[model samples]
Target: MTGRRKQGFILFRDVMHVILAIVIIVMVVFAFLSPNKYAIFFPLIFLLFSVSCLLDAIKYFKNEEHLKYSFIKATIMFILFLFMLLMSTIGFLNI
Candidate 1:
């Protein structure tokens, strides 16, 4: 039962990673195609990264592995996420 549960968890994590990768790729492509609209997509990309880091932190916390490192990374990512979000909103409004 434990083995199966671990496998399931791994599968779920892999799926989430793949989805995030696809979304990031699409965002990058759109940002490149429409350079003028970078303000909108760039912040969104950071948001995704922040979420990914948060998820990693949670996983590491749960697994009792590298707690300090993961939490610190997540904290930094969240701060950057907020900064990018605020800046993008202001930029969008100005334009």
Candidate 2:
């Protein structure tokens, strides 16, 4: 049923949230301890961040009960992620 499907998606979104959080923490620590190796994981970091942004956008679209700023925040995050990704690809990051 639709309810079950929605619940499943919610569960997935929650998992993604947790995974994104962990990835961020790891990325930060790795950056501080091993800056040279951090660039190697930039692609994976980009992927995870993209997924997190996507899940937020999908959740916001599916459930409009959230505040207006929530959508704004999600949109900003998505744009920032894309910008960072593009910059990284162009060697602007230099990290």
TM-score of each: 0.59, 0.68
| Candidate 2: worst-modelled 10 consecutive residues by lDDT | 86-95
Instruction: Kindly state the number of residue pairs that clash in model 2.
Output: 0
Candidate 2 residues lying further than 4 Å off, grouped into runs, are 64-74, 91-95
Listed per model in order, the count of residue pairs whose N, CA or C atoms clash below 3 Å is 0, 0
lDDT of 1: 0.69
Query: Model 1, residue 65: what's the lDDT?
Result: 56
Per-residue lDDT of candidate 1, residues 1-95 (tens digit)? 38788778878877887898899899989988997867587767766765665555545544545555766676665566566566656655665
Candidate 2: what lDDT?
0.72
Top candidate by lDDT: 2
Residue range 40-66, candidate 2, lDDT tens digits: 566556666667777776766576568
